[model samples]
Target: MLQVRLLGCFALEQSQRDQSAVLGRNGRRLAAYLFAYPNRSHRRDKLIDLFWTESAPDQGRTAFSTALWKIKRTIGASGRQMALHAVGQNVVLEIAKPAIVDAHRFASDIEVALSASCADSIRPAIELYSGAFLEEFDGDWVLEERERLEVLYVRALTLMMRQAANQSRYEDALCCARRILATDPMRESAQRATMLLYTLNGQRGQAIRQFERCRATLREECGVDPMPETRSLDLMIRSGAVFERIPTLLNETFGTGG
Candidate 1:
């Protein structure tokens, strides 16, 4: 079976053998786009527009055809199992059954987990997302898909973090909160959550330091102070009024205590 890992880097493996080197640069890009949206038909014209916008129509068509042909030649016999097909006015890349595409699988798993409101069930999907979707590529299409997947990833992380906190797994929840901040440092909610988690884990000093970091980040990045709620939480923590009610406080403040 062929596997395409387009999560962090581009990789192609067939029968446990690396085949990424066989496809040249253009072939790799063409294959990446097709496999990124497996089983869906992309209008040939649209594909041409996306890949060869600078060329004349005839020239673009030739380029698309040549690039696609090179991909097929690279696949050779595997083309029978996983092949590109012309369906009416569209081109479809058909992935063989049992083939793995990390991007597609991650999106599907995250969607199902979110739809079912089973945040804990998304761990597998979270594990699959090693990094940003196609971190090596940048195009309008790639950017759109990247952003969409990132939102889903962050949402899954948030849900899992809340679940962990509810279970009193402070360290795990803190890890997730840190990941969220890494993705978007401007996420005040995550910043606040991190601080609360640190305090809940018996690291009051660390929590206070976290607040300072948050304040500095907000001031440097947005030229603003932490939100009023954040400030109030900081004061409550410093006064030690909220220590005894950490669980209830987390629950009320961010739905983490459950």
Candidate 2:
């Protein structure tokens, strides 16, 4: 099996062989673009523009053709099996059988989890999403796909936090919230979840410190203050009122639904 890992550092892994002859940068990009949006045909001209826009028409076509050949050679049978081919000016990646694409699998698993409304079912999706989709690549297309996956990751963490909280798994919930904050420090909801979990664990001092950490992150990152809701939580922690409430609207705050 040839596994294309787009999450975290991008690497193409084959189950039974060395990947010494990896694709070139442009080859990798073409492979990633096709794998990221599998089973679709992309016009050769569009791919040329996307990846080799600065080149003259001939140079771009030459570069694209070279990159395509490199990709085919690097990925070999799996590439052929998946129909990673060009036909009459269109390129395609068609995987009729199973293939492990972390980006694609992450999105699919999340949809299933969301459909079931079961955060527990989402654990695999969260685990699959090790990092932003193709974090090493750059381009307009890469940025859009990266940001979209990042948002899904954050939302998945939100669901996990709420689930663990409901299950009284305070530590697990806090861990999920921290993971979310690590990726998106501006997420006040995650910060709040962290603070609440600390409080629930009888770590009031830690809860207050989390609030301070949140404030500092916002100040340094965005030159802004915490939202009013966050400030209120901070005040509640300071006044020893956090333990008095159950973090009301438990279902409302972290719900992934409408």
**RMSD, each candidate, Å?**
2.7, 2.9
Candidate no. 2 TM-score: 0.90
> What clash pairs does model 1 have?
none
State which candidate has the highest lDDT: 1
lDDT of 2: 0.80
Per-prediction TM-score, please? Answer: 0.86, 0.90
The digit string of per-residue lDDT tens for model 2 on 168-200 reads 888998898889988988888788878877987
Cα lDDT tens digits for candidate 1, 1-258: 567888897878788776866566655777889888878889989888887788899998888888877767656657556887876788888877523788888988999999987976898889898888788888988889998999999999998888888888989999999989888888888888888899889998898898999999999989999999788888888999867777677777567544
| lDDT for position 96 in model 2 | 71
Off by over 4 Å in 1: 15-18, 21-26, 56-58, 76-81, 87-89, 96-99, 244-248, 254-258
- Please list the residue runs of candidate 2 whose C-alpha ends up more than 4 Å from where it truly belongs after superposition: 16-21, 247-258
